[model samples]
Target: MELEDMPLEKKRDGDGEGTSKLVVEAKAEGKQTEGNARLYLTGCLFFTLISLVLMLAVIVLSVKSQTGSKDCPGTGDDGRCWNIFPKIQAQKLDCHQCGDGWLLFENTCFYLSTVRLNWSMSQKNCTAGKGDLAVISSQSVQTFLTGKAKSFFWIGLKHDANQWRWVDNSALGVRYWEDNLSNGDCGLLRGDGPPLKNWMRASCNSKAYFICEKQHTSLLTILWTTFFMYIKFCRIYGGDKKDDAKENLSSQLSVELEGERGKQTEGNARLYRAGCLFLTLICLVLVLAVIFLSVKLQTGSKDCPGSGEAGAGRTSTSLTATCNFDQCQTDFPDIQHQKLHCNQCGDGWLPFEKSCYFLSTMRSTWLMSMIECTTRGGRLAVISSQSVQTFLSGKRIGLFWIGLERPGSQWRWVDNRALGDSYWDDNLSEGDCGLLRGDGPPQKNWMRAPCAHSAYFICEKQA
Candidate 1:
């Protein structure tokens, strides 16, 4: 609502401009007063608009502060909408939070993953964990999982029992598995295991570790031993306290409980934020990758098979099937990318253009970045080729170092190459644009925007 819409304490400035002092005036004439009211109304409208913009900006920032990360599928507690972070509506029930490739239904985790191990070993492991090969019944679960794994595995069902039986020994429900037309076949999913991401068929003697599903609920409730419960019990039993005393106690208790809750909440919030940020970073990487892949797919006509692990900074050439969290490792190694090259040259450097570029460590004036890069026996990276441009294109959105800047604010190329016209963003000339690391400017479609703005910097020197 506009401020003018509500009656406010009246105040007005004197007509004199330079003589600034506290002064209030009331109109004597009705016509003049009406005019004054109109002016006030107009001012109110203008101020209201400005207020609205600021409020919206704050709200957006607030939302970003809370929800600024990627979405996760579970929160141990029941979810609340006002939470700074949001959880994925679906509960992830994988063994040890191994999210994407496994499914948890009922009290067990089922391997929707296409990982290969002997059917028997997989069964024994699942049996040890109180679950068995997947006995999927619902179409939704099947569709949700099979879409990713795109293959099948030996489930708990086997032919030795002389009947279609699940490893759990429970009566088989309606099975939605599309048959391969084998009459004596046991339960099987159409998938091969790790490294292949393909399909295979075999007996139950497989020795792979089975993924068992469990509910999102923790093992047991310790609420009775918790601080909140203790406070409640104390409130009910403490009778001799005065009403005011009781209230004070309750308030203090409430604060303590809230603080405790806040601690958990904040902890979860931080976790959520971290998860989200990681996810956001992942998604951003994925999106850029997808774009690049799509481009590569178009150019290569789907003939050049790319390795996901190789793309993720692994230095090995072997096709790795899974991630190893103990060490920051991915599947394929030996495949080379510009970023991988930088990874090859450690100490906050990323490889690009057959040269090492420093990571963005802190924002500095262009002069500062140049000096630092120079100290490292390099200049700010000036991306010169399509290969370099494409490599940098896949990086996170930020201002980063490049080997270009205004010397004496002349806005000339460092190489002293004769120029036909200056290439800069926003029509900025030598004076307005100042300096650029990339030909494109900050947030420009092709330009990385600014250099040395993030907490990291990239210094590059020729090989």
Candidate 2:
């Protein structure tokens, strides 16, 4: 009976040992599975993080390309390309300020006079203040001044030499004249009527309050501010969010992985929550990126000012999408029939077909010619119509520079319009500026010349 009991006790001990061994093996296998799951999760996370980083890099590079250092026609002293007119329209980006008692609007500063004076006296006072009398070129400008005007204000328009013209000698663009007003040479803005029809003809000697306008001098500073602000915002709001997400994910994983098998379901639940949070953050980032790109495109393309010939000094690339010949004709009716005897273009300028053409007697390089034309508030001539071509050809006595230039493989006008009518005298493939040969016929007189070569140039502006 004792021997039988001993054998039974040994068998019981063996059974206990076997049970312990099996439990240990099960625990080891569970640990291995958990380790593998963590490894797989980490790999997926790492790949996702890398992909996010790469995507962000692509976005940054694309933005940089748009605002890159392409040569602007008028570079500032700091070697930075600054667009004057376009920057004006971006008032929120402006860092400039007007003087005391001056009102700031767009890219210009205006000052309302406290005293009444005649047109000549008002202009003289404005000039003394380093500005000119208010010149309203658009309906927005008219509305702005109309809001500020309490009484009759002397503007820069005048019926000079039989046609309405601005003080700068530019022909009126959009008229706001009230037909019932008294006839006179000077222009006045009446504050009591419709904003668009408040203008009235007044005597040059009539006394009235005046408005003065001057261009702001802080363009370069504004550009520097905008560039740095954009970079800083991108760093703060664009790229750093990903790093925060990575840190949060790491913290969550460490906290959730601390427990054993009993907490396995809880760990998986935490992991799901973490993954959802990460995915949500990523989705938010993508949405923000899309919004950023949309705004950049709109501001960089559509709303950019200085796209026309008058404002193309900063960006040599013109955004004029259509041929302006018909528009020019529409703006000035019967422009071809308008008498040249009006002398509206002043001395040395010849008026033809709603535009004024000035042939420089002195010779200059193409770039210098463009600069000079810009200074004179005009551009190098763009010959669009056959009549204009005949007129320009007839006026030229030598190789004269025009506004046409080959920015790329195709020749384009300075205003960025594609070359429409061809009058090439030679198949010249090398040179940047277009030259009109005076000796050849109008139909076949165009020539290409080196931009660096000195030649007579013709400047044109709205007459």
Candidate 3:
């Protein structure tokens, strides 16, 4: 009802109630607005924190990339810089490239001298080239030197205090001594003989050619260079952004880059898996081929027997088979049958008196040679008789290891027999084992030598 048409007391009561309801509704609307404002502020703060975290992650990644690059040096025409993200042109290096006139082998460079010089002077020449006299350490290296050395050449070996040593002050572990020499402080390699019989001792003042050795550029250097280049490329392409608009743009770019990288990583993974599978297949095929070849070889050997006289000798009824095809056997009925006896020596063994001897073609250490002989059900040859010694000395042209050894302070045979009727060389001063000197006199052909020296060995067994 209108205020003008209402009674005074009733009108006052209705107006107070309406006014109170309006005040309560106004308070509720103000609280709702405040809550909405607070929620909006909280959402803004959360987004800002997330953006900051993403920026921090990017910075950390950049720092790691930069730190990793420090270990790798610069290479190529652009110094240390690279454009990896854009795939721009950059220089590459071949780290294994050797210097001019230097031959590469494994990870080392070797230079052979054509002119002659004394041992000291040759070492000086090698030092001038930032290298040392070639130190022979392996069979492959020894073979290489043997091929290059046209005549007696000087090596890094020197006799110090009656012991042979290398230029690096390392004691010789694997020796290839040709003979036990009393004099000569320097080492020489004979270019004419086999590799096992090449090393010999000579005077230090003797003039001869030499070899120099040095390390070549390594693969690790190339890997480091590549890593540095990649880091430089990342720094150049992933520059920093300040404003939000630029930051958003960079975020989009980074997302795209990540997508590309993911795709590339997947592709590389697939390629690696495929390569592994292909190699596995190749290995399996090779294994199958080897098995098939081995089976075929065994079958062929079993099927094809010895031919002609050998076959006839192997058969038990040779006369009956020969008589079955020929009437001439009836005409020569006076022929007598005889049984032949074979030698008692085993296969690949030489019969000498009541013993079987085996000469090794390969060179090995004294202990290793002993193992080989034991594996063959024998032991190293014991020179107990002068006739046996004379026979062995006549057969070998180079030093051959015997069964004699010096276990404690005295010389004894492998059979634990004491030294009797010794044939030791007069000039022998130091050594732990005895060797037959094939180039020396028959009466004094035995000489003392280090047990570690590589030489052809002799094994003996009962006949």
Compare the candidates by lDDT and give the number of the best one: 2
lDDT of 2: 0.64
Candidates 1 and 3 compared: the better one by TM-score is 3
List the candidates' TM-scores in order: 0.25, 0.31, 0.29
Which candidate achieves the best TM-score against the true structure? 2
lDDT of 2 at 236: 46
Task: Using lDDT as the measure, name the better of candidate 2 and candidate 3.
Answer: 2
Local accuracy of candidate 3 as per-residue lDDT tens digits, 1-463: 6776668878778876766565455445544544544454354345434434543444444344334322222223111112211121111211123443356777777766544568997787677667888888898888887887678788899999978899989998787878665468988887776897788888888877677787775433443453365346435532322223243444335444444444444443444344334434434544454455445433422211122232332223223323431332233221111100112344677756557788888888776676566445466888888888877777767887888888799888776679887787888856897887777777788888899998888888755
Rank candidates, lDDT, best first.
2, 3, 1
Question: Ten-residue segment with the worst summed lDDT in candidate 1?
Answer: 73-82
lDDT (tens digit, per residue) of candidate 1 on 376-400 = 4455556565566556545655555
Q: What is the C-alpha RMSD of each candidate to the true structure, in Å?
A: 30.0, 22.8, 28.9
> Residue-pair clashes per candidate, as listed?
47, 0, 0
Q: Rate the local accuracy (lDDT) of all candidates.
A: 0.40, 0.64, 0.60
Selected candidate, larger TM-score, 2 vs 3: 2
